[model samples]
Target: MANKNAPFHPIIYVRGYAMTPGEIDETTADPFCGFNLGSTVYRAVPEKERQPRKFIFESPVIRLASDFGYQDVYEEGYDILDPEWEADPDNKVPSRAIIIFRYYDEASRLLGIGQTPNISQFADKLRLLILRVRELVCKNPANGIGEDDFRCHLVAHSMGGLVCRALLQNPAAEFRAAVKHVDKLFTYATPHNGIEMVGVNIPKWLDMNDMKNFNRDYMAEYLNIKDAFKATGRVDWLPEDSFPSERVFCMVGSNRMDYEAALGMSRTFAGHGSDGLVRIENAALHGWRRSGKNKGSAGDSCAKAFAYRAHSGFLGIVNSEEAFQNLTRFLFGDIRVDLWVDVEQIRLPKPVQDEVLAGRKVSALYQFEILASPRGKLWYLTRRTAEEDSVACLSHEEWMQAPAQRQALYLSSVFLANRARVNPRRRSLAYSMTLGVRVPDYEVDRRLWVNEHYEGGYLFRDSIILEMVPPKAEGDAWQVKYAWQGSGVSKADTAIDAKLLGDSRMEVCVPFGSSGSPGMQGQLRFIVSLWNKEAAGN
Candidate 1:
């Protein structure tokens, strides 16, 4: 039986964009099921080993758009392919992609199918499809019915991620709400940012043709292309504006095999740091912020919930274990938080220390969010298995103990070494460093929950306190004090004097070792103030 206070919930896995026949095949192709659903690669083998396999080919239900008919070289000059140019050589070639959904039973067996054409019409058709799926599942009797009726998980690949993102961010409140009913989303090789399809510059004449035929005003009526284009912005996979990252789990491939292809492109749009097509930065919610530190709001609470993983290639990303782990974890974790910590101290380059005299001031602390249960038990979520009673608790020291973990800790450093290497201000010696926020809790919370309420309310009323020990120089001791200025304040600050951190870290707590409350509702402020041994100013 689940603990009375546990809050465990079932998970729904949502996968991302899968290119349709139009998007991938020069001619019309079938909706290609990603490697996770099992590849359609017809493996040659011995005649004795031959056996029947589940095949998903083109669905007769959907028709190909005439404009999408195949052609040789693209005529469009615009960086992005516009649908109107598919027919004319003078026009830019359209990016052919597909949309298909396959429902699965609880046992993970394919149940039914739904397919749609890659129309220029914004998500208008996709919105209707979401509603139709809801209605169909609820009404049909042969469709294995259950109390958890809304069991569909949207699995998209490539451009399909963009389609799903549009669905999730639909202005139509009904459509947005309907899509929320879907359990989860899984995406593979989705260029959340615009994909670089062999970067073709259209002739100046094609630009004029777009103004005449595929003009924003003209396509706005039936296709809503203007808004869709606006939402996708430079990034075709995600909307131009921010999205709720929490609900979605993005899988990004970091392989940069097409380095030569991406060399001529602008730094911002270059896919050299991406999976042959989409950049890793774009695969995540664009306006991602650290959970606790206020960086202004992206306006969508649900959107804040998402997890991302890095793998090698476009096709390999979907078929790899990393993708599967990220997908399943996002659908199942119990504690979710977007955490980011800045290492201002690391900015010191050794020689410059005497110039400033005192150690560099920490403009921002190494911050990470804590998504433990109401009962202050992080162990509930971290435990390895059901039979295990304890889970490994990670402090800043343990977290960055390994090289891989340390590298992850210094994200800003990582980005700087890669595509973000250009120095903006050489004359000015000072440099600004920022690290990408890690939805650290998302992997642990959504994926590791024993039930909906992490460990099924095992902790009851206790609140968690998270502390990190930094790697500081020996004998250069410092004291750490914590304070919170939220709706409720603790009676006294918790002070740690010991060398809790081997280097330069101090212990910090959430809810700050305070007494339990009737229920977990109010937000508590947590501050870790550092003081010198001489009791000088912090």
Candidate 2:
């Protein structure tokens, strides 16, 4: 029997888009669609000359079953849709099961009359499917699961994420009560703001063959969101009141070159700052604000992470370890921390300051690199860099704004498993994070500019070490230790200071400098707090 207090729940996997008829036919032919697809290779660095390393992942479907005791509901090559299958007299379904929302089956020639429905239709079907799953799991007494305790997590990839959103957001859709059954939603490379091709939003006028499903205007209508056509404005794709944004996780893909689709034309048209298809800016659901006037609004911020994987294929975000770790941790992990960097001051070089003092039009672009690794692990839990992955870009003007009101750069949402700690008996968690500030190039007057001597394109960087120990009993304060790398021969060689600020909240200032040199004077304000797990609905 499963642990009564355990957070383990059923997971519903939704696959992505199938562009062509052949692709749809091939997808329908598969038993698990793309959820069963696994990869044996990965590239540590996004370089053409570097060969990918051999890392075997037994797919999400197999991993969930092998690692967590989750099972598929099929029996002897028979699916729930099979006519011969009937409900057991006990009215029980497995506590942990995976249900693939085969929304594209009817579009395939082998299944139906090759007629595809719009996203709204798919969402309507999703509502019914949730009801079906609830009946199979909650209503069954033999499962020993209560109706109030029955909930499932939705894991979707690409356009399938939009389908999940529509089911939860669209008011016109039937089966409204089914939305309550969804506990959490995780999306991989979803275009929440709609896809753009060659710097153009796929025109809404092109409705032939359901091409308009990707149009922002058309999506707004079906997803029931307001202000979808705002080109340079913010749009909230997920409804605010329907579900808490904290329970939603968006896994963004940054490596565009590895997505070998459409004879390499897909990457060409999608351009840079994307996962070869969805733009990095558009990949996440909206309403997440770190600062400014909208800081404390309900459903304002959702958890998100950036990976170097592409949208799909061998290097796809869904098939990578980065995505898998994030998925499993978000669903099962107990501890959470939301990190942000507030720029207190940005000191420029003497020459650059002189140019600005002389009324010369000068602007510098800075990219923020972040990497997090747990103790006793060589691989990073999350990585965002300038060269190979998602980099937060800001201009000099943006940095000089008021520090309090200025928007804070979101670092990463770190989730640590209580049982997976280095020393489980100690009830302590240890992790190190490195933040690199890079000024790759600057613009004097919106022109191509290059620095004469650039060392690895980094202007400043720092690494932080954090150790956390939550209180075992209520009313007791939590304990945390934080230390940063100081200038020395090595991190261990330096006399570091580990400070404890109260219990739940702490503030620290990390000075940034170049590699092996300490002169580029700038400091980043870090505000670390223990995320409210109860309020987050975890």
Candidate 3:
């Protein structure tokens, strides 16, 4: 039933919170529990009033079915979760299936129990679901699935991500081995650090539908991060001994205005830099790797991406093309590229330069933005800007400090070579990244200077598109081509290649500077490496 071994593991979808009874019922009523719901709109698409809409990406469930031939366990009007549902001898469940972790079913009156279960119980159900899926996949003898080789990928949104985390990080005595069955995790707009509103954490007293489960203190208890939380004041972390955070991909949402929950009041409470319900800063977890500066400190953060999508809606992060693309690639991609920015120098404007040259102190803040996307797509995989309140900002003093003193600037990582390329004839994997630095607000002599300032001005902006052709045979030379957008120049025009660092690694040096004026000068360094190639193909 399966040709591939690593990447095609069965995917189990864990849905988000059902804050109220009606929402719980609505989720319970659905067969796939909203995992089957599709979206017709994306962040770049205009409002519904705009016509000639040509883009309509189906739900993740349908996409998996159509693209990868994954099927559900529903048969005879019964799901695998149903006790009465028995395996059909004539038809065996496909090894590659999209199983929904319907943790909320027990909470609906139409289903089992009428009361909603807390997050702990939800984790319990998740463990059982994995084991249950294992039993089903192993049922068919021809499938050749065994307990030692069977694994599942967990795709979750919001609180559902926490459920899986609960299982992985800490499970009940009965389900302590649940972590062994999970290979990778992908979270959509999950408040890994715990959800906050109005600048305060969700209170423990507010127990509506167990909303208090989001309280940081409470989460630390169930997730078994109490000591970590006390030491770091955060519950967003996965113990390396249990599961490395690098295996978790977090899709963080940036648009709060489109959440529309509570008639847009939720956005107001979440304020800016949020997805209405979850703040952007709280949407991802910290990794386990420690940095060189100190041992036993958090370093090499968990993989995460930012999009303009909201928490959950037509514009939600879950149902959007951006999220779907990320989810699939992280699960099955063969190439992983991590981007880093090294500022060689930050030149000032003519006037600002003159002030600095005269020995007068000048203070300024620089906002850096990066937009990354794959080939043949209009949407971005990871986007960060000042407007999104997620951009990397550096003060002039910070820039003056040595790179060693300052924390390394990590833009985002992109996974590729999973979804079959559009042009099978072309054997190269390609993508583009746009890096821009906004003109800063200069303060000479500690006083704000606005005389020559113009709003919405950039110090430098350009797109670096890369085309990587894999080695035809082992030890053969791998070819790489690159160019800056709108420069009237490409590798096709002038044959060029990236500087090869070593085996399985390539570095593309893209230098940027303002024309005819004193401005920023730096080169973006991209390190592309082979992630998991066993499943890579056209």
Best by lDDT: 3
* True-vs-predicted CA distance for residue 417, candidate 3, Å: 2.2
lDDT of each: 0.32, 0.74, 0.79
Error of 1 at 298 (Å): 3.5
Candidate 2 clash figure, as a count: 2
Q: Evaluated with TM-score, which candidate comes out highest?
A: 3
**Regions of candidate 2 where Cα sits further than 4 Å from its true position:** 1-6, 87-91, 172-175, 228-236, 288-299, 403-407, 445-455, 486-538
Candidate 3, residues 238-292: lDDT per residue as tens digits?
7776687778899999888778999998999899889889998899888642324
Q: Write the per-residue lDDT of candidate 1 for residues 315-393, one digit (tens) a residue.
A: 2445433344344334433222222232211222233323235543212112322222112111111101111111112
What TM-score would every model get versus the actual structure? 0.40, 0.88, 0.90
Q: How far is candidate 1 from the true structure (C-alpha RMSD, Å)?
A: 21.9
Cα lDDT tens digits for candidate 2, 256-368: 99988988888889998899998888988755332356543324467788888899998898888778888888888767666676555566666665666887766777778
Which run of 10 residues does model 3 get worst, by summed lDDT?
Answer: 45-54
In model 3, which regions exceed 4 Å deviation?
Answer: 1-4, 45-54, 171-176, 289-295, 350-363, 403-407, 444-446, 490-503, 515-518, 534-538
Model 3, 207: alpha-carbon shift in Å?
Answer: 1.9
